[model samples]
Target: MAGTSDPLTPRAKLAVTAGKAVAAASRAAGRGSGSVIGGRVALKLDPDLLARLAQNLDVTLVSATNGKTTTTRLIAEALKAAGPVVSNALGANMPAGITSALAGGSESKFGVIEVDEKYLAGVARDTDPKCIALLNLSRDQLDRAAETRMLAENWREGLAGTKAVIVANCDDPLVVWAASSSPNVIWVAAGQMWKDDAWSCPSCGGVMQRPGDDWFCGECGFRRPTPSWVLSGDHVLDPHGSAWPIHLQLPGRANKANAASSAAVAAVFGVPPQVALERMYQVQAVAGRYDVVQFQERDLRLLLAKNPAGWLETFSLIDPPPTPVILSVNARGADGTDTSWLWDVDYTRLTGHPIFVLGDRKLDLAVRLEVANQHFQVCDSLDQAVQMCPPGRIEVIANYTAFQDLRRRVGN
Candidate 1:
């Protein structure tokens, strides 16, 4: 509505109309990616549609290697208490997707956007977000994103011009380095479980010392920033040292860290921590990250893990040994072509559990499991995999394309 009011010229309005028509046609034709197409059309016509639409709006941009979608949803849900909120709920996180979301919700004055890691700086600069949440950074989409350190440097440079309040994860050294230059930063020690990607100091390139949960560089004396918000046990510790219990429908400690970061962002907008936590508890599933779908006689709990770091975190959320699990891996564009990251995952933890592997890269996963000495059966289809599992709940953990395939097959 910011751009739709009187600020937009007649030509801009016409471009918006044409883009909307194309999006509508795309949806009717059964192509689910209408948003990106629409945004592309609008941008091609005007070129500055995103910046125009973002003017004068209160924006919060959420970015991370993982958990961007779910964390953005949680932040959007909490922000809804203040008023109507706009967000990219469908997980189209690039410039075009973000432009489409803003164009669709033109009337809303507040927005929470999930930004792709590579596009974080550009999106933040264009949107001029009031609060920018910097979640943990790790090795992701190596084919396109190059190196994690380079991505952090891009973020550091991109955010140097913004006046936005920065809420960052102190547990991740990369996040700390990226946000260190921000004039106004609120550090949160939202637990970091995976350390394989961050063994060395990002600042001095020295060996990082991790005495406990806190990390520091022994060479240049670059240490983890003292956090104002921290996830301790089952509660989130506020700046005042008061603890607030976290009760979420979403599983894993990763989600808890996400909730803590969301709460911190909400607090920047004057949203009470209690209200934020209460609203977070109501989030049953984010896109298809934690959805349970019934396939034939079996109920499958879906968990999406795109890389080694993600797999490590997701594996901890399992119900433990004796619980039957299905693992799906794909080498499609969305899942990244390199299936070598599978070997980096600690599959030995899954040894005692009954594992069923299925996907385009099922054989690749099968080999990895066999090398790890984990007992697993390879199924050609989801139905066969579901039937192979013991009666009751079956946990299905998959990469990008495989996860989407499962969601579509089960009608989730």
Candidate 2:
């Protein structure tokens, strides 16, 4: 027999190296490992790290274009409602970030992780989660993801063989179609989540129909059952206003969808609906993604607008502009390196006079806003933008790269 070498010995070295590398690069980049920003060095590690880490724990992986971070955090909290658990709740949804998170809590029994769409297959194959949540597919990170259709196809291919208890959002047609093809699937829907951005039929190119509050393939008449756990009006005590004594502590229609999905998935694992709702209500915002901050006497709400889907959702929350919005756009290689994705975002909905556009690429943001015939004041620096804005109610839309810049400059 070969001499016994400690199996954990090699992993210990890898873990130390991974942690040091993540910490060093993040420090150099003026960010932290668990923050909404992705670490520069975490992507350098092999994708198998998360899979290796998952071998030691019972894990649940959540993936989607939007509502992922919230859903991931919600599920983790829901599970925690039943008992103690560990999670990678920093909004770092890729394989490496999940690795870093799991490595940080190597001793925990349940590891709930949020994963990006692109890395779903790789992480799923490696980690083999006990449960998985596939939220809706939407136009997100167009430059990086190319398109939502491509993401849907990738997800279908990736999740074909996974033995996870799949919790899927059935409201989105694409998600419903994908989940229908999968075995052992549970559906979660957001009834009347948003009617304005209704998707057209993929096959016939006709307007998709919503009959009896349930979406269907308009052309083909491929009617699917309404989700078992639809968000009823009664379930949502407050859709827009915050803190109305609902099941979930968070507000926003989008947050309701996220909470619904998390509740559905938790219920699949024997967590009672009442218990899940109670735990979800205890959940709060994760850092700057939707974190409300009081800085320089201004009540600022920070939201991540990495792609069109996120921007659209954020748009629905705040009142029509002239609210002195702070729009930040930055160009870095890691943050898609190209600002072309900005065009995909619907800039028409946002109408404001002299909006404060700041960051490394403030001029680009200004130009984009100007083309839309919206008033935007270009700032030489983020500090100037902060100085220009008054306290009490400011909305800041920061892209992936812009968020890092904002944190350093605005103390948000």
Candidate 3:
């Protein structure tokens, strides 16, 4: 069992020990990360294991449709600069995975946790975090995770009276509405590129009016809150109107927005913006996303775009025109069961790049690209897809499971 200042109950100690054994066995067997499965067994023995493990730690919960893992990693890095920090850095956001991580890092002074949007309320209740960062919400894995508005309302209802300071994205109307219930909130103008989900106000189900960058509901009075932290082009301005130059090893504007959010959350832990951003610069990738893998005589830079909003951001991160791009999609359990979300993205953005599509849902993606008047070659595997392109450096963008599949294949 992990060493903690607060002594664990006899059952809790036994549970933690059993869980560690299972996780070690799992890793040795080449099964998986083993965090979730280990935590599950621990929780079965002691249902309150997560809460017990997190009780003595200063925890920060990060929830979003996208960028949760990366933001969590950034906050952890900033917090690590201050002192010891713990995090589930392997893209696991559920209670089970979180518990396993907490148990492993029992003596860490701070904890940065990534939580799924649907499970934010429950995890927050158990962790009693110092703060909760709410990133933008969009339609993702809709089959299992309810609609965006419904998830927002869940956040609203579940977090009505809690004391966790909410660090929320003001540009996202849904996030604004959800965080509205919490009085102690630091609104951040982290830009939202996907507006389809926010055009309808979550407040009164009325039309939302967006005149330029500002947004307000026409029918209801709910409007965008004034932000204390803003992410302007290549810069982040703090509340005092001082600009912090955003220079990150991670590519793309979306990651810059993530950095801005992380700086805000780190401030609660007494970390200054300059210090936070300076430490965050050390993070080059989250999990395997944005990491380059050498495969079949080509350098394939991996990018994970799990939804329409994610795809929009991914298009900006890849190499320029004439560079070959490989796109993959899967409707596995981790990904949503429905492939209908493929139609939401505008595939025409890849018009100039030599595009190759593969995965379990390659046919579905092919049909969507056809409808968008985009040219794409449908192949059966990553190797086949790369062979279709004459590539020295190729780009590969995949959704949840598909990204993991290729990450494993290349041993990256």
Return the top candidate by lDDT. 3
lDDT of 1 by residue, 1-412 (tens): 2343555677777768878888889999999869999988988898887877788579999999899999999999899889789899999999988888888776676889999988998898788889999998888766666688888888888888579999999999999999988899999999888888788888878999999898899999999999999998789998998899999999999999999999999999999888999999989998888888778877789999998889999999988778899999889887678787888899998878899999998999999999999899999999998888778888899998899899999998
In model 1, where do residues sit more than 4 Å from their true spots? 1-5
Alpha-carbon lDDT, every model: 0.88, 0.69, 0.90
Q: Per-residue lDDT for 1-412 in model 3, tens only?
A: 2245675789999999999989999999998989999999999999998888888788899999989999999999988877899999997789989888888987788889999888999999988888999999999997887999999999999888778889999999999999999979999999999898998889898999999999999898899999999999989999999999888999998999999999999998889999999999998888888888788888989999999999999997788889998899999989998988888898888888888889998999888988888778899788888877775899899999999999988989
Between candidates 2 and 3, the one scoring higher on lDDT is: 3
After superposition, the stretches of candidate 2 with alpha carbons farther than 4 Å from their true spots are: 1-31, 34-49, 191-213, 218-221, 234-245, 319-322, 338-348, 352-354
List TM-scores for all candidates, in order: 0.97, 0.82, 0.98
Which lDDT value does model 2 have at 253? 79
Model 3 vs. true fold: TM: 0.98
Ranking by TM-score: 3, 1, 2
The sequence of per-residue lDDT tens digits that candidate 2 reaches over residues 318-389 is 756567788888777656657765666677777753478887877777777877887678887766776788
